[model samples]
Target: MSADSMRVRRSFSRVWPVALLAGPGLAWAQVSPPAGEAAAPAAESSASAGSADEPVASSPSAPYLRTQIGMVLETRPTYLGSPNRETKLRPVLGLQYGRFRLSSSRASLVESSGGGGQLSGASVDLSPRGPWSLNAALRIDHGRGAGDDPLLAGLPEVRQTVRGRVSARYAITPSWSAGASLSTDLLGRKGGTLGALDVGWSTMLTPAWRWTLGGGLGLADATYMRSYHGISPEVAAATSRTAYVPGAGMHGVGVSTGLTWNVSPAWRLGATGAFGRLTGPAVDSPLTQARNNWSVSVGAVWVKDWRD
Candidate 1:
């Protein structure tokens, strides 16, 4: 390996833990109020442009643009260890321009919503069909510091990373979709690569209420597995933990369900719950204490539509 590769590996072993966006487990729905009617925007409502599950609505004379702002609350593992839990309040922002979209928050690709990940940085989308979309994104993966937990005090600090991802989504019907994604280390921060496949279904229960369901499979490469789960002998001796190496393969499976209510044309309310389990090396790693991962999020969004 090159010197840079060695350095990256060392840094990988020393890095700390951070949060990931709970993708594949959430869904979204968009509904426009009856024609010739308008609704007041609520400060805490959820309304945004159409996602993958629906076609992008448009006007004959103007490009469609919408902006969404909101906040989400969730509890997730502090690191990969699962022994520590962190509850965080994450701000949400999403924008749409014609066939282009941008957002910091994530939704499953199957729902044509930007699938889950961290709630920072930005992602861009391109759709060539009413039912298919492609996306590229840059995001921050917060690193972990050994000192944050006694069990990791002597380990190296994992620094924050800026990584990139490319993904594609397809809407099979107005209420169902499927997609895939690939993410890789862009900043060379020892961040590894990840791949995933997802499917989702959404429907309207009433004129104002909608619900969605989704599931996914996750895969990791050897580099990602070793960087995040591998243990070195020297360090194992120091920490008195067995040195182990993990191989790359299928690593996780997840499911998500969500509900949304349109209070008005401009305001919306939504909530989601997701459950996931680690498999293969991720669960077998010495650093891991549990195999189950779960989260819940609730938020409201207010949308502003612009004509150009």
Candidate 2:
């Protein structure tokens, strides 16, 4: 095979597992139709009062204030360990001001700045060219603590870490996009580097409904692998656990699918489901019991268009 073909094959191999996790959800969420076909009613709603034979006028775009709130129920392994599951209720929020956006779901923010450029909680991007754009950012990983779970009673705490990342994305088609990111813990809190690649697509089923699907793979450097998954002799002796050092490798993968329903021009509702699995060192860690995690959520959004 040609070099490009080989690269594509390798990429698919890495992403296949994630796709499998997210694939079935597509069928479950496919209760809609073509995106273009879904917008007719919304356009008609904005028209001025007129006879059927008169041309319907279109409204101009305006600045708006938007916010969302929701509750999520999720099952996850206790402290990244313990086969036992913990059910938790989480509150999620999203807000938008002009070109600025903030999402409690990811604890992040994004805004347009400096003449059409964009800035996000972790990165920045200049004007996008054609179907491609590049961005860079710094991220924080609030490391784990033994006190976070009973299963981690004797394990050492993993402190907060700061990482820098660069990413590039391309529009594969009007409805699909793909991207990859590279990141490294620049502050040495768990000194390591990681990479990921993902693809996503969305479609509108009706004037009120839309859904999206996405999946990705994760890889880590030896330092990152060891920091989060390895047990040193001293730590093993102190904690009474086996000492096992993990090497660099693919750590995990996951997928997600979600749907949104526009209740009106000012109100919307959403639901999402996601699944993930741990592998490599993360799976081999003495602290690890269950390698799989899943979550589901539902929420609503409210918006106020500003005439100013």
Candidate 3:
């Protein structure tokens, strides 16, 4: 086998395990598809497997370290579905090598990666070039605690739980795509199953500027609903709130939009915002302070990379 053939084979070998953990691929998890969408991995794998004996050679592009450093300012609700909001200032830093990228969902090196309900955390893209993108991520779900709010004083103190997620996104077009992702409580603090369905569009305003808009539908099973939105009988009695139990259904809908400017090869700037509204049983719960939530983010990015 030639060097080029060997490289593809090696890539396939590394990617299959991720595919298994994720049940194959293709589905929108949250985030932007890297500027240069990966080459079609399935097609390349198939073509290469059939011609393993063919002699071929092509110089590999010199590897380069791509890094982004900056700061992001974000504003959103104090809690999910909260009527009040707060603003946060966070540092932005990210790096990518070959097919693997390490970055926050907002420390974008490509373009905007927000949907209606994006969570901030660390994530790694474990996908090859193509229509499919997959990510393994970890985040903190700061569950509500007693006294955290006057209304939640008597309710159980939901200890913060670390969480993990596996998601996939498929690009249906250069400007359209759809995806689904599943998240689970890694520490098992009763943060039941949560999911999101993503669909979005992007277009260039100029050679160096782009616009993106995307929608995400949120879903939660009984456990997640009960923990985050429900008022149990015992808790309701103590707190004098109405007792309610919720089942699985479409819990919310959200829309996110962004304006990104590629000021130069090493400098980028962007602004993004999202609006979300709770639906289904979650909307009917008495504990719900409000059915609507929103957030906005702005950032400046400086990148260190060498290549076209």
Candidate 4:
């Protein structure tokens, strides 16, 4: 009721509303966790989500571009002639863009006949997307022998090859698919054409591994010469032989199998084996006949991108 008491009461009344309005906010501020703890779980959850998304990182694109460049050391033991031996150091380059692939390879026979290396080849492959994927490839190769080299001097030759393949796949399960392919090859010669056909089955052993097994028949005409050698002009002129010594128009059967392993998302390793037997008119020719022999090759392949 006194002046001092009334003045104190008036001041308290003015501050009460503001204090009441700030109470809940202040309580919340005090109860909140420290900055580090409050942000810890959020950061952890975000990292987990990122980890979950990684498996799908490679699936976004179609018609990916994959490329491989590597060297292959080959050993050939003389089957028909003298004990011919050669070591080759080769440089190989390959490019794949979308559904198309191109490659070229050159090798120098380190100790062999010609001053110029023996063999070189170039190939192009096309694989387009469709209900059934179709793959086609063409290759050309040449081999030359030095004048002094006894075994290959008469064998200097150029060869062209064409191959076509059609394949279709059906998914049997989430992790398994069954597919079949039909393939054929045509060899061009100065005299005639040689043709071969193949049918094969491919199975996916895992997401990163595959295997193929196949067999086929081959037929060649009189002028059909193998790509590895050229008939000597002197012999051809004297013998008036349009066909190879073994003659032409021969038939043979062959079997082939291959395995591919994906070492990483960007690299692969492959091994292939082939065997053949020759029959028919040309079989009599020492050079034209196919012998029961097996060839095996292993290679490493690399790819740049999997996106279109």
The model with the greater TM-score, 3 or 4, is 3
Model 4, 72-165: lDDT tens digits are 4433223212244333433344443333344432111110110111111221222233322233333332222233135444444433234332
Positional deviation of residue 192's Cα in model 3 after best superposition, in angstroms: 1.2
Candidate order by TM-score, decreasing, is 1, 3, 2, 4
Better of 1 and 2 by lDDT: 1
By lDDT, rank the candidates, best first: 3, 1, 2, 4
Candidate 4 clashing pairs, residues 3+ apart or interchain: 114-146, 221-249, 246-285
Identify the superior model by lDDT, candidate 2 or candidate 4: 2
Give the per-residue lDDT of model 3 (tens digit) for 193-298: 7776666676778988877666666677788788877889998888888899889877676666667688997788877666667777778877678777666678
TM-score for each predicted model, relative to the true structure:
0.72, 0.67, 0.72, 0.52
* 2 versus 3: better TM-score goes to: 3
TM match of model 4 to true structure = 0.52
RMSD of each: 14.2, 17.3, 11.1, 27.9
Q: Which stretches of candidate 1 lie over 4 Å from their true place?
A: 1-64, 106-120, 147-151
Note the residue pairs that clash in candidate 2.
33-205, 122-137
Tens-digit lDDT track of model 1 for 1-308: 56654664455334311112322111111110100000101000111111212232112223344557776665555544456666666655665443344454333111223322221234445555366766665555554567655656566665566656676767777666776767676777765777767676767799888776666677777766766666778878897887877878776766666677778877777776666667777787787776775656676777666543
lDDT of 3: 0.54
| lDDT, model 2 | 0.48
| Candidate 2 lDDT over residue span 218-262, tens digit each | 677788667667788898999888998989877666666666677
